[model samples]
Structures are given as C-alpha cells and as structure tokens.
Target chain A: MSFDGLWPYIYIAIAGWLATDLWRWAGVVAGNRIDERSEVLNWVRAVATALVAAVIAKLIVFPTGTLEASPLWLRLGAVAFGGLCFFIGGRFRQIAGIAAAIAFLAAGLALLGV
Target chain B: MTAPPESQSQSHWFLLGMRGIFSLPAIILMLSFVGFAAFTAEAKVPVEQVMFMTGMVWALPAKVILVGSMLSGAHIATAFLAVTLSSVRMMPMVAALIPEIRDRRTPTWLLLIVSHFVAITAWVFAMEKVRDVPRGGRVAFFAGFGVTLTLTNIVLVGLVYGAVSEFPPIVSGCLFFLTPVYFLTSIWISARHRVIYWALGIGLALGTIFAVVAPEYDILLAGVVGGTAAWWGERALRRREAAR
Candidate 1:
C-alpha cells in the first residue's frame, strides 16, 4: 500500500483509541468515587448489558459475509438449537451448546445442499 | 468464611492469575482471536496493521467494525464513529469491574493502565476468580490475566494470518461464528439478574425487528429502548414485591 493508503490505518488507530479508551479512563476515575450499589452504577450496568445483547442480536439477525447467505430460518434455528442445548446440558455447558449450534448449521447447510 | 491473608507478593499473585487464565478462558479467547485473525486476512488488511490493532484496540467488536467499515469505503471519521458507538458498552463493564479489584491505595496510573485490559473475557474471568485472591493481589492477578490474553492474541493472530490462505471460506466463516456465539453464551451464563435476561430477550427481538425495518441504527435503538424497558420492568416488579 502507498503512503496515502497507510494514512487510513493511522487515522483509525488514533480515532479508535479516543473513542474506546476515553470511556475506560473515565470509568477508572469515576469508579474511584462511586459505590457499587449507586443508582447510576445500576443504570450503567443495565445499559451495558442491553448493548451487548443488542450486538449479539445484530450478529444473529443481520450478519455479514457468508453467514448472511443462510436463510433467516436457518440462522434463527441455529440460535434456538444452541439455546436448547445450553439448557438441556444443565446451563453451564456453554462450549457444548455452541458446538451443537455449529453442528446444526453445518448439517442444515448440507441437507439443504446450499 | 475466613478471609485469606493478604501477604502474597505482587509477582506471586500475578503468577496465580496467569495460571487461572491458562486454561479454558485463555483457550476461548485464543480461538476468538484466531477467528479475528482469519477475518483480517480475508479483509486484506496487512498482517502488521492487524497486529497493531490487536495490541492497541484490543476490543474485538470495535476492531471488526473498524475493518468492516473501512473495507466498505467508509470515510475515516465515519468508521471511527461506528467503532466508538459500538464500543460504548465497555464503559459500564470497566466501571463495575474496577471497583471490585481496586482499593484506596491502588495507584491511579495503574488503574488507568489496567482499564484497557477490562474487555469482556477478562472482566468475566476476573469477576469470577478475583474474589478468591487476597485484596492486595487482585490488581496483579487481573494484570497477569490481561497481559497473557494480549500476548496470546498477538501470537495467534500472526500464526492465523499466515495460514489463513489454506482454510476454506466455509471453515473461516464458521470460525467467525464463534465470536458472536461465544459472546451470547457468555452473557447468558454470567448474567445473575432476571432483569438482564429480560433485557437480552427483548433486545434480541427488537434488534431483529429493527434490522428489518431500520437496518442502519438497529443495534443502538434496540439497546436504548430494550434496556430502558427492562429497567422499568425490573423496578415495577421490585415495587410490587416491596408492597406485598
């Protein structure tokens, strides 16, 4: 890549650093002053939890790349099957559940001949 | 239960922490990073730049967004905005986690440095394991775990980037699936509050609905609206219980 092409990486590094690290530094400073049970902390936790969920949902619902080629039913089915495996394996078997989902997706793809 | 004596040296505590993450947690994180390495290779990002991002950026989702947006011809500012918005979730995680491992005597500079290590994997592992370490040892423990994770990523990303050409697209795609699936499973496993469960379910539904109807801002909208709904629902339930 040329020098101009490299400019984008530098920009991404600086901009991405500011975007993410600002929160971490702010949290460290503010964490020193706040009690865990404070309402503000609770709200922050709520928002964070929801944001992570939203990210996961977006991945499943609006995935990019080859995963996006699968039908919606297949995608949703993989998640549901994974959830079921999670529960059936006594809820602590996370890797097992994920493996099951992967297996389901592979098998479904094969059966569909897609 | 009796508290463990807080007499361990910082190095000792750090070694213990390293040992703790040397197992399943580290394996999971390594696999995730390898997946990300494959992803960067597929995106045609340079190996050196990928390593730089892995070291500096650290957060997978933001890194993914940065690469995805930039590859799609997004302007630098637009890519930055997308990555930043996606990563706003880490703030609460850091806020909640630092308090658990910190004390009045903890150095502000140290706290600032360690905060960079407070990603989802480290945070979850630390929350579960830090309680067992003595008070003074907690920070060292987290630092060790965090540093190990980073080093592992650096090494694995290098290896995967070189070998990515040998893997089929389907194999690489399945590996990519591990990232989001792992996040989803971890959240479900770690969440102790019923309200958070409600938030996740509602968020998933709303995210899907919005992705179809308004794909551009689906995640942001789902997070704000679904989280607010879950918070309100939990508060109402708490009030009813108190009244009863």
Candidate 2:
C-alpha cells in the first residue's frame, strides 16, 4: 500500500525487461540480410529451444511459487502424465493434456490434503 | 521467402494467437511477481516499479534477480551486475536471431520499439514463424506480437495484484505448471536431431543434479556443460558416420 513498498518491484521489472530488449534491437539491426536456414540461425534455434526446455525442467524439479509446496511425486506425476498426453494428443492436443495433468495432480493433492 | 500480402494476413493471425496465449501464461507468471511485491510491499519495494519492470524487463529471471538483490539490501550496482550476469544468455539469443531477420530493412525506429518486449517466449515463437514472414514484414509482425504481450502482461500484473488471494498456492502451483508443460510439449513436438535429444537428456540430468547441489548456478552450469556435451556428442556422431 505504501509508495515505498511499490518501488522495488517496479525497478526490478523495468530493468529486467529493458536489458533483454537491447538484444532484440541488436537482432533487428544486425539481421539485415542473413539467411534463416544458415548455421547461425539453426544454432540459435537449437540453443534457445534447449534453454526453454531446461527452464521447464527446472521448474518441474524445483518450482518456487505455489509449486514448491506440492509433493515431489505429484509434480513428477503431473509432468509424466502431461508427457503422455503430449504424445497421445499429437501436437495441438498436447496443450490440453498439460492443463489436464496439472489439474488432475492438483485435485488429487487437494483430496489427499497434501 | 517473401510472405505474400495474403499470407501476411494469415501469419498476422498466427502471431496474434501466440501473443494472446501469453496472456494465459502471464496470468500465472505475474502472480509470483505480484505476490512477491505484495508480500514485500510493506518492506519498500514499489508495486508500480514492479509492474513497470515486468513491462520493461519482460524477462522474468532478470527481473527477479534485480529486485531480489535490492530487497536483500544489495546496492543498485550489485543488483545490476547480477541481472547482467543473467542477461549474458541473451547474447547468444541475439546472435541467432539477427541473421534470420536479414533481407528486411526495418526502419530503425520500429526496431527500437519492438525490441522492448522481446523475451524468450516471443523469441522462440518468432524464430519458428519469422521465416515465413518476409524480412520487411517481420518487424510489423513482431511489433504486433510484442505490443500484444506487453499490454496483456501489464493487465495481468494489475489483476494479480488485485486478486492475489483468488489464486492461492494451489492455483499458483497449477499455473506455474504451465511453463514446464509447455516447454516439454514444444520439445517433444519439434525436436528432430539426435543431438537435440542427447542435449536434452544431458541438460536435464546435469540440471537436475546441479539444481539440488547449487541452486543458484544450475541453469548456467547445466547449459554450459550440457550444451558442450551435446555439441561434442554430435561431432563424434558425425565423425563415425563419415568413417562408415
């Protein structure tokens, strides 16, 4: 409620987002004529994809927020269930499976009072 | 390939879908930030400042470090340094995207504006689809995409701040589940190379192990070790293939 209390979050948000913008600008500036299929783009795609993957894995394995409280088995089950759904539903159906896995896990946890 | 005017329309819609889905993710991601702000608000971290940073910094990890360091009583300089260390990942990200945007001479002004909201999520989606857009149209598409996400995130933060209790830990936990679920799905759907499969295995193994041992540097350490191992593994595979 206090103005003083609000400032830190604001500062963090601005600085964090802006620092990243610097690169997008650089990409636009430098991307003037490069081929998308070239080795560089492929590496970028691979690494970026890899990082996003790593982030997802980290969250499942060591979640911070609400997830931190959920039992480890539930988290792993949700991921594995989601993985199964992903494989079963094909590409688009996988999104729903993710939601379902989480929902199921959460419901089970709630029922068990864990 | 130049995206024809009509294809551009379709692609625009596609980008819009990508942007809109971010709202769903933002609904969850913002909760942690809002919760952190609300929890720490009495301690002097600005809510507006946090909201503004969420918009400006767009990247969650850096934003967390910047404010977390400051909250810990670290000076702005230290906060900046820590955030910058995390920002190092963006260098390789930029190196990869620049060449893809080649061919279109987007005006300097628009690039400046679009750059502000470019985050890992948008970059991944854009990289996949940018090739379909001609060099010139990429900016507009990216602009439209970035703007959509920026507006959504701001609204999301505001909502999270206002409705903090509605999304209790259970809801928050469920929401947080989206990141991993989404990424895992994307990898399963798109990964083609054996190298990628190996990289993922190594990254997950090392990342999980190191995460427990050294929570602070897990991502960076896993990335470096796993990435290098994957690279070498692929090289070795290629050599064997050639020899055969």
Candidate 3:
C-alpha cells in the first residue's frame, strides 16, 4: 500500500499527541535529577496545583459543552455546596463532596426546569 | 522519599492501585464524559478519530482544545501551541509524583512509562491516596489508577459518542458538573502547603478575569502568573518568619 494524502490525521498526531506528551516526558526528566525532598519539588507541586485550580475555575465560570447551558449560579453554587461537604466529610471527604455537588446540581437543574 | 514507618509496611500495591477502578474519582470521570460526546459529534469528527485521540491525547482538556481549534479552522501550529500550553500543568504533576512513587528500588523506565497517565484526575487522586501507601507500591498504585482511568474513559467516550445529543441540556449540564466539583475539592484537600491555598485563590481570581479579557491565553497566563506569585509570596513570608 502506498502512503497517500493523509495530512489531516498527520496534523492531528503532531498537534494533539506530541504537544501534550511533551510536558510529561519533560517532567519525568526534570523530576529524576532533583533531590526528592528539595524545595524545588515543592515549588513544582505548587505550580501544578495552581494550574489545575485555574482549570476548575474556568469550568465553572466559562464552561464549554453542555454545562454551558446551565446558569452560572447553578454551577458555582454546586461547587460551594460540594466544598462544604468536603471539609465536613472528614474521612470520606472526596466522596461526600462530589456526591453533594451532583445532588445539588441535578436538583437545581430540575427545579429550574419547573 | 517516604517516611521510615510507611516504607516498612508491605502490601500488594498493584491490587491496591487497580482497585481505584471502583473509586469515586473514577465514577465521576465517567459521569463527566457522558456529556462530552456532543462536542465531537457536533464537530462531525469521526468516532474513530475521537477514539484515536482518547488513547493518544488522554487529557480531556487537551482533547477539547484540539477539537476546538479544529472547529475554528485554526492552523496546525496554533493548535499545537494551544494544546501544549493547555497541558503544561502535567509537567509539575509528573515531576512531583515521580519522587513520591520512586522508592530506592523503583526504576526510571517504569516512572517514564506511567508518566503518560498523569492526567489531572488521576494525578490528584494518586497524590491524595498515595500518602498512606508504601513507597515501593506508590508507582503501582498510581499506575493502576491512571491506566484504569484512561481505559475506562476511552470506553465511556466510545459508548457515548453516538448517544450524547439526545440527552436533555439540564441533564447533560449536571452530569458535566461532576468534574469541577470533584476537581475543586480534591485539589483543595490534596495540597501539601498553605502556599497552594494562595495559588488556588489567585489562580481562580485571575482565571475568571482573564477569561473575560483574554480568552485565548486565560489558563496559561493565570496559571503561570498566579502560580509564580503565590510561590514567591510564600517564600518571602517564610524568610520574614525566619528572621524574627
């Protein structure tokens, strides 16, 4: 079989796959050389956490996809409710928080439909 | 490096990690994905292409970025840069997690391989759970969660790709809300330092502001600028406390 025009898939691979994986490989290489308990590792951890926090905020404030259909208050309010349960759940914090969010969100959406 | 007490404890880490398949984080991820199919379906991207991306790109945000840029008819170079910027958070995630997973016995090659699975959900879950796990088992534990998550989401996306648009908007909206809920709490609870609190607050404030002003580079600017500010801000505080 001869290789024909497949620039779209080729473009997908280069842009989609390589772009994302580049950081993972870099992280490993950088992580390998550092002392485990070093302050530098702490800083890197901080950066990662902040980056994800940005993602979470963006999802709530300016979401894409179907979530964008719901009112922004419903979105932010569910997280607030979830965060409350997370702090209160103690041992099962993650589960409690997520369950609370879904319960609150689904309920709010249903109520809004009425 | 792990504490002395934890390292001495021996357990079947692979089984422990693999057990993450049943965890809430895993379930919530599936829930978030149920509504994700519409984006790809709307784009008229083939199911096979979505499957291909699910395996190769792995990160949900990165996949969204790719499909989004394509929808806008962006150049390959722009998409490349966007995806790269979007996934930049994965770097520190891998960097921080590898040290935790590597005992003196864990190999570099193994860490490199598992690094591919370090998406936001998996990384946050492993970071939270691995504290109680043995260092020798941390890698297995994380790999179990990461690999399980990736495979499960791939299958979930495939099943939903053809079935998404029929769902009501409210239902889809609520289902997709699981991610931000799970993410915010997990990220808050998993932070190892108070500086992370600073980072979170600053990141959120700046993320919101930037989304309004500079939509294209919001996450990038907020993440880098907010993260760095929190980092140095905390350091300077520590220096002052030490001087007293």
Top candidate, metric lDDT? 3
User: What's the C-alpha lDDT at position B196 in model 2?
Assistant: 67
lDDT of 3 by residue, A2-104 (tens): 1124665776799998998889999998888778878787677777777888888898888776666678888788888888988899998878888888888
Native contacts retained per candidate?
0.58, 0.43, 0.71
Write down the worst ten-residue block by lDDT for model 2 chain A: A1-10
lDDT digits (tens) for residues B20-106 of candidate 1: 656666777787787787777877888888887887888877888878876787777787788877676677778777777987799
lDDT accuracy of residue A57 in candidate 1: 77
Candidate 1 displacement at residue A13 in angstroms: 2.3
Quote each prediction's TM-score.
Answer: 0.88, 0.79, 0.88
lDDT of each: 0.76, 0.62, 0.81
How well does candidate 2 score on lDDT at residue A18? Answer: 48
Query: Candidate 2 lDDT, tens digit per residue, A1-114?
Result: 233655555445444554566655665555544466665444444555455556667777877756666678888887777767766775456566767687777886687665
Query: What is the alpha-carbon interface RMSD for each candidate?
Result: 2.3, 3.3, 3.0
In candidate 2, what are the lDDT values of residues B19-93, reduced to their tens digit? Answer: 645443434444445654444343455456656776777776676676677667776556666776666556556
| Candidate number with greatest DockQ | 1
Question: Looking at candidate 3, what is the lDDT of residue B184?
Answer: 81
Docking class of 3: medium
